[model samples]
Target chain A: MTDPRLAYVQRKTRRRLAFSAVHLVLYFSFSLNWSSWGEPLSHRLGVTQVTGSLLMFILLVLIFIGMEFLFLQMESKETQE
Target chain B: MKAMFLFLLRSAPLLVLSGVAAAAGSIDGEVEQQPLNTTAIVMFLLFVVMTLLITWRAAKTTTSSAAFYNAGGKITGLQNGAAIAGDFMSAASFLGITGLIFVGGFDGMILSLGAFAAWPLLMFMFAKRVRNLGSFTFVDVVSQRLARGQIRIVASIGTIAVVIMYLIAQMVGAGKLIQLLFGLPYEVAVITVSALVLAYVAFGGMLATTWVQIIKATLLLTGVTLIAILILARTGFSFNELLSLAVEKHPKGEAILSPGVVFKDPVQIATIQVSMLFGTLGLPHILMRLFTVPDMRQAQLSAFYASLFMGYFYLVLLVLGFGTVAFIYGNPEYFDADGKLTGGINMAAIHIASAMGGDILTGFMSAVSFATILAVVAGLTVSGAAAISHDLYAQVIKQGEPDPKTELRITRIAVFVIGLVAVVLGIAFENENVAFIAVMPMVTAASVTFPILLLSMFWSGLTTRGATYGAIAGFLSSLLLIVLGPQVWVSVIGNEQPLFPYDYPGLFTMPFAFAVIWLVSVTDRSARGEIDRANYHSLLVRSEFGEKAAGEGAVG
Candidate 1:
């Protein structure tokens, strides 16, 4: 006797968990590849390691800001619906 | 191979004697050698003036219990985000970790990176739930469906234990810094730092503390970035050259860039890494910052920013650590006449700075380090004050309408009490490896708090009895294991045998807590009906959208 409501909640939880898992794997893979490949590119680009790190940091910050805006816009759309 | 064996045999006696001397009188002599310079004196005065000014400003907004405890719930996410960075970037981040990497090499950097990796998990999992709950203590999130009284008691105990442990660590660090830079006696230094931190938080409240943290973080980042650039210039911006120089100096240098060379035991390394990563999310001081953000979105953003900043800072520390080994470690001038590395890791950063530029640069860096200690101690005091005054006093015992004015006074008193206790503990543990010992208490807090917090937010069936039992089980098990573990026994009784060979017990304790909560919740049918339909709906809505949608739905 599975409660339909509990089943629905479980389904949603599983989806969210799957999304998070994917995101985490992507992040880990990208960081590893970048650390290995990015170092030489940084040198070739005439950027010191510190300068290269700062650039990456700025990029990360912008990505987060963009995500926040996107999330907020989606919330607004949901409210209208 | 034969030469290496002879070298080890020759050095063993000196190492043994030094260890014995460190336990006896080494710290006291080190304290006497360095006195406070004019720059350090001026910086201390400046900190005092700034603290007073901020406290005065915070006094205007702190008119109620809510404002005093949580900045009136009006702080924007960006502001709160910066404060979160401030709080997380303690003396441990600035001085301790940097020193660790300088002395211990790769083992230290791994610890930092492992701790930093936990931030994303915290953001994705805990932050939104914490923000939606809008409670002062972490227990507030876990106890949403539980009896208020039960949650209050359990939460207060966990909060108190964690705050005390953290405060003691900060106090010890402050004492050590004072001894190194100011030549003050350890007892005097501990008292001075404790009193100053208490004053800042007692008067400033959350608003003042936030501003202080922001200022501290700004100064720290600026100082370190400058030092990193300077070091790069000195090395002609050649990363390979620096590495080669380090390798040439010590054949073991390459091992530093790689892992597992220092610890050797595979099991110990795995256990330690797991503990450092997961235990990070459960830290009480870190958790308290989530309550400061305006909404869930801000919470997530703030965590992302913190991780980025922390990662950048750690990379700089890698430079500083290797820079010290290359430039200052064996220099005759860096050591005292006895051939001892007289100043230890605290001097590692400034020595390199001096070598790069001159005495002027060293003075400036020292001032920055001094500011780092003050700022970190202030943040620790405020978080501890919140647990004592808000969680224990207003929510738990009083249960009366929280009068802001009276609560502020109580918070001040609480700060004083916490500061006094820290000073005493700092003095007692002056000779021990304070940073390593400090991590144990945080581990205990994380083990207890993390499982209960996670289950409560995600598991709708988490019952009151289950949470209470789970928290108690996690707290007691972790605490007992740590006390009986090698670190403590080695500190107290000179014993080498570890009860649980693992330095961190989270891998064992966290799952145990989750199991207890599940088992108890399953058995307790009475708690099945405790969930509020409206509140649960609001939580789900708030997590997905933001607070505005939840508010609109409530009105509709």
Candidate 2:
């Protein structure tokens, strides 16, 4: 964290770590919660047959693809500095 | 040693055939013969010809160790990403997972989700740094900071162990798949896949392997998309209807859409997630893909693309897996006399293809699967060969200075030997439940390679002795647990109770390794350990910035 370049990299790394944390939390919550909570994912959404299980899966895929895209964009900008 | 290796390799097939027949409950059994479908044969032949052409072109350019190891570092982000996807979509995941879904409904989705759970983290953490530090292998990055020779030897052992286990899993799956689809004998199926892999890796090396992977990924994605579309078309393109239809037909009833239908244990769920998330980072073949790209941006982009493709693929699998329940579950045609799937649950993917598109589609899927096995094993072979030649032979045996010619020669020899071993082992494990072995590499990777690589790169205080001990500790603990886990003990050994209750080893093993490395490093005050810690500064600088910061080569 001494050199300016190194400091900048650290700043970017913090953001990456944040994203990773959210990812792990979201994933573990969706996957492991069913066992302890008695099928929380089975609850249906408002007026639709689409259940929480399907919703979680879609949310995960979106987050997976979206976060990686966002990270690539941010990293590209940072490296240009 | 060579004789013993060959002897073990040669005896592998016979051992699998007998499956310890002297014992009553061993794995040895009969393989149901498949009909000789000429269409499937034609499709598979076409894939083989296409692969041979790719290898022919690649062989001409593979002159040096660099070219052989990483395709001379000229691959693009898009190409590398597809290649990474190709590597990820092994026959085991593509077929085995769908099989799980076909039987267990929403429960089988544990693996489909578990598979891609690691990617964003891998992208956010390791991708760019790995590209910046290593040339041929990930060990290059580790050796940059630690004792080069000893660490490489240690890492090379780790890599080979992971690679060999992974290779056998794919080989056995491929052999059975080939027999089931193409009506070839088990031995012929194994040899055919191995021989083609030997050609691709020995002569064409990474370039051919990468292209083949890219090609296979494209085919697999295309095939999956077609089947998904057809399935959706049947249900008027509504996922809810598909789910409803699946529920109506599935024996699990409404549980098909609910969790805990397949995996009810909290420990099992946690273990599966942990292993998939961490073990992915340590897979040698997957990690090796980062170096194939020319620079860091490409490396990051490739991971992005890989996750995109895989994510898309997995979502599509939910549809197809449910579709198998909707269409294939009650279809007695696909069932044997015992009321099981004729080729087992894995055939759900292919059976669904037939339900929608008939024999031609089934043939196309079979061919794509054949290509998937070949590309994955080819990728594994090159990485395994690199461990043998680049890390073990060059870094350790030659003290880090290797003649280009000798190294390339050794790599090619290693490729042939590895291919032979895979073919033999494939034949040997024909009747065994190779699913455990298929996932073994991921567990092994989580324990040894993943921890060492992460500590060496990120943890400033990691000394050589600490890292080595961590590896040995991680590997031994994971191995012992797996041997005692339900898969081996209760299932394979017919024991009443498993010493290790869970199959996934990462939850216990990875943290244990990190702790061991931490304790050992903190306790060490040796002079050499001080140097190892001190080297962290240069390693960090070079990894974040570049070696010289002049060109793309230096701009990582």
Candidate 3:
């Protein structure tokens, strides 16, 4: 069996890597929305450029806040335990 | 082949001379003089006098290192937010983005949004943890678990590199702004601004720096808001009317409302946004501001308020940029005899200001932009000084046992030296339009320091060697890539081809730095590595619940 210390370290590293990946994906997704890649989303739906851009901006902020809130909840749970 | 060889031989001397010119840093060309605007001079002096008075007051209150570096952690959330806005809204954002919009049209809106998008990530990811962990510098957080001496040296080097690069860019921009507004010689303008920044940082420290930023932010916000309101008023508060007018007046017509007007490549777009996002994350001066707030909650509030102010200002920039096209497009008065922008394209927003409110309001806006440059340079200088004295001398060299008076004295001396160096470099680069030079240091920070900072905060496997190597990789790669990039190769060096085509290098280098740190740290089996691994749980707890992890009976 693997040492408990090594197993713990592996678990923590995976957690950190996962969280960082999510962070990267959010930023990248925001970039896609701002780029020509997301042009079809607005064009096909008949959304005006301004409304589409504003919606993207609002969605980005909400997602960021949600992620933070989720982490804070985990921290609080850890403290209670 | 013979004819081509003959042509090459004939043009060899001219090519050689151009290369020589590039080496001499003479590519930017000299600023042409216009009649001095006395209104601008008077308004600028008025601002100088007020900030000097605030510095004198701050000098009295700055009695200890804590007060000088982080203002004793007493600044209110709202005030800190304004100061943060002042710090980030920089000459590049105020003048450069407006200039881009003036010239590039719809492409300018993307640039403005790039500036606004970074703060959400900072507020959500790093601000509270940064505030909770460090007292003065971001390096403080890294030194908490890692070996202090080596980590401090690496972190300090990164901080100083970012500051110097940023300071040089701001100084040159400041000189050009003064030259346009007051018709002062570039050297004289650079020297004057540099000396004033030195005096501000040397006398008042962070307290003075914070207040200067606040005042500058308020002035800028008011100035830009008025310009936007005036632009809107001219259109009867109608966005559709403004858009139609701008499109009708612009040379490109409806194409000015489209994205491919400037940026055509998707990779380039993604690279620019990625650099900006990561760049803000690792900027030493911006992170230093977090430590000046009272607690994590205040720190979060600081980022939130800054985002609001910045978002509103960027919207204003968009309108003003398009508005300039509406009013001043093809207008001979705003252009020189060569059909070039009279004060260069960076003065697009200023021309809009003049058109909106005439000489009086133009002078106010000019003074506000000048104040913006000064406040930014002062912040950079103070932080550079701290890197040298606090990080290098007191912490690294002296092992945290330097004489307080001597260290403060060294910090003051460093400030003066940094200011002088900036002035000299500013004069040499007076002709270059490196307003995008601000982007360079941000990319560097994101590539080099942000990885180190993020990994140190979150990763248990982060050893001293891992952190050091990771940062070195990031630093060297960013510098090498930027030197070979189009900005330096084609624009500055007047080369035909760039070794690295992309202007921003963060997308590739930031991830590479993170990978290097991970690979090295996971293999590290030293005693220190094991201890650091064990320390991660506590760090996370502290990062999350503030003082509760330390058994301090739960923090507010």
Candidate 4:
């Protein structure tokens, strides 16, 4: 079995990496002003503006939730160990 | 003089509340002439009644400092998430950031995005460590490996400073909101908010604060989502069309879609973003909420949930802010005779509500705004109370010998005192455009509290003297720079020249804070410094592995 302390560190490191990746995406989007792309993206995707923003929002939420669940799963494993 | 002062202080709340009632009554004729938002008033009162019931329940559960400060660590992750969101997304956010977007467009989005960026960092860096180490206050975490009494004294000073600054900002926002939505006098609004906040916090403590926050967050999220849907429906659900309509309706035309309206320089922009990022990480009330959860996992989950909710809420703000231009831009009902936006631009969200769903929806949004202000103020008061009663009175003053009864009593008295001070300052700054006041506390938190906590947690070389002096240095420098900065210097002090060129001091002072702690710790050769350095290994182990070590129960 993996050392629980080492496993905890690995899990934490993975979360940090995931967070950094998301932060990078956000930073570049805001810096390059690509956040305003939802309007055009919606038009190209043949969706309403509301749907476009909502879809984007739902996508971001899913990503965050996925990352969180992974972290929690690792935490549970550590506790079980 | 002292006796008279004591008597006046004791009767102040009653005096203020009665004065508010009389002032509210005197404006009856004018208020009657204007169309009444009776539905809004009724809904607001209903909310107040419901929250009071919650507080009454919470008061019975609050018996010890653990219960008073942390709600016995029984709050679920989701509930704590909502409460944290409530504490964060205050009236300033609902009104101020939306107003920023309505006026400055992309720049407002940038300001808001900066605020939201702090959450991911909170989850990554501080949330778990803070939850694992602290019970009641963030000071508990900082003092865990240091000298408890002295370190807490310094931490309390930082806590109360941030609290008072944040309180004044919330109070001003509440006062202005009531005046706009209910046509009440500003002083009366300030007093009314203070009274309700005091009742909840002084009686129910953290449990009530958490519930109030959770309820307000739910209401605010629901209300904003409804308005966003209405606005999108108006625009045929097209983001492009919404932007086009907003540009056409707004006086700035296509300039609204471009950045650099409010914040011009890139350095200034970066400074504000840094302030927002670390500032939220260090806010006393927000940090205090992390302790309300059961354990590190709950704390982590709470951060995740809060970030998700806030991310969605902020995106909704983007819609609400830009949608105002499409819907309410030229509406005479939302404008003054001079063609200015009524209640300044901050009423954009409310105007959008009125335009979309008429009086009932506007009333609901108005009531949510009131609840938002009240909930945030209650959160602030509880944290400020813990700083005073837990950190100052019990730990520092009484050397941790105070009984539970005395501690609880001190906490209640601190709540009253903090509420009264907030009211007085809120009323005094009524005409001062205190909207920007919210940013100051965040900057101060980033500068002072963030450095001290981060250093104490991670650095083995950091001593008690270093933490205390570093905190003082960071605290004083941030406040001093803000005073010398353009906002206070030219605007508040009516000066021709600002000593500090920047509006925000975070970029400079945050680094300086870290440097001061480094310099102080590295140079110190004292026996206490040696002991504190030696204790750092255990602190690191506990913070990293969730193991209890020495000083875990030092404060409690």
Fraction of the real A/B interface contacts present in each candidate? 0.01, 0.58, 0.06, 0.11
Query: What tens digits encode model 1's per-residue C-alpha lDDT throughout B56-127?
Result: 888788665566667766667667766766666654455545544455444454445554556656665677
**Share of reference contacts kept by candidate 2:** 0.58
Comparing only chain B with the true structure, the TM-scores of all models are 0.87, 0.92, 0.91, 0.91
Candidate 2: TM-score of chain A is 0.76
Residue pairs in steric clash, candidate 4? Answer: A49-B237, A49-B238, A49-B239
Give the per-residue lDDT of model 3 (tens digit) for B1-556.
Answer: 2232233233322222211111111112234465687898899899899999999999998876667888889998889989989988875577666666665566665556666766766765678777887778989778777877888999999999888878776776667667766777778778888888877888899989999999999999999999999999999998667877887776666666665555667787777776777777888998999988888878877877787788778777778877887888767788655456676655767889999999999889888877888888888887898899888998888887888888888888898899888987787767665633545687788887889888777777888888988998898888788778876787678899999978778888898888888888889988877877776766765664565334211111
What DockQ does each candidate score versus the true complex, computed on alpha carbons? Answer: 0.11, 0.64, 0.16, 0.19
- How much is the TM-score of the A chain of model 4? 0.47
Model 1 chain B: lowest-lDDT 10 consecutive positions:
B20-29
Clashing pairs in 3: B28-B431
The lDDT values for all models are 0.60, 0.78, 0.73, 0.74
Model 2, position A30: C-alpha lDDT score: 65
Provide C-alpha RMSD values for all models, in order.
6.6, 7.2, 7.1, 8.9
Error of 4 at B550 (Å): 3.9
Give lDDT tens digits, candidate 2, residues B219-272: 999999999999999999988888888878776677767775556787777787
- After TM-score superposition, the amount by which residue B75's alpha carbon in candidate 1 deviates from its true location, in angstroms, is 3.4
RMSD of 4: 8.9
Candidate that scores best on TM-score: 2
